[model samples]
Target: MSKNKKEKLNVVYSTNPNFSYEFEEEETPETLDPKNQLLYVLLDKKQRAGKEVTLIEGFIGSDEDLKDLGKLLKSKCGVGGTAKDGEIVIQGSFRDKVIELLTKEGYKTKRKGG
Candidate 1:
């Protein structure tokens, strides 16, 4: 009935009085080295009311690292955006600038989607 009880849905009853439920936590992947990561920089405007945004994808790393990279890019480009779901979205069409910034940070970048 409670939140904790709902988690242990598999076991209706436990014979052992000392029985405890072990919850498995998902682990985030380690952040890869900048030079070893291949990132794609693109311009998108499909669902944004015709406004353009620069998207950086193909990043294999933890969420923290992704947010840090997004922060750096946003600050350098003087724009606002978000980093989530393994992608960084910058608030404007700055594909070339994003690629240059990523390159300066030692990341392998490729421009995409004209």
Candidate 2:
């Protein structure tokens, strides 16, 4: 890590588990609300074979803010990803990394399914 990177990391703090519980629960696609902190990264069957990153959307809320946040998450993971259809879709099984990023950003996050 370089000086700039270390400085940026200084801004990150340990996440409180209490604040993240609800957002981490497994939810049905129908019940998921646009305003929630929950993030879903669904992988398309056809796309799995050919890419290092996957498309994820359905984050909802302020578009500009979420998009920027998505980019931050992707970069922190050292991978490429995108934000679309209100979701932040990164290119790998980055559940733990995603969880850490979102939690640090003050959003409760969770991993669903296998």
Number of the top-ranking candidate, with lDDT as the measure: 1
lDDT string, candidate 1, 18-107, tens digits: 998765455889999998999999999988999999999999999999999999999999999999999999998889889899999999
For candidate 2, which ten residues in a row score worst on lDDT?
Answer: 20-29
**Deviation in Å, model 2, residue 65 alpha carbon:** 1.3
- What is the TM-score of each predicted model, taking all chains together? 0.84, 0.55
- For each candidate in the order shown, give its overall lDDT on alpha carbons: 0.91, 0.60
Worst 10 residues of 1 by lDDT: 1-10
Taking every candidate in turn, the Cα RMSD to the unseen true structure, in Å, is 3.5, 17.5
Residue 56, candidate 1: Cα error in Å is 0.2
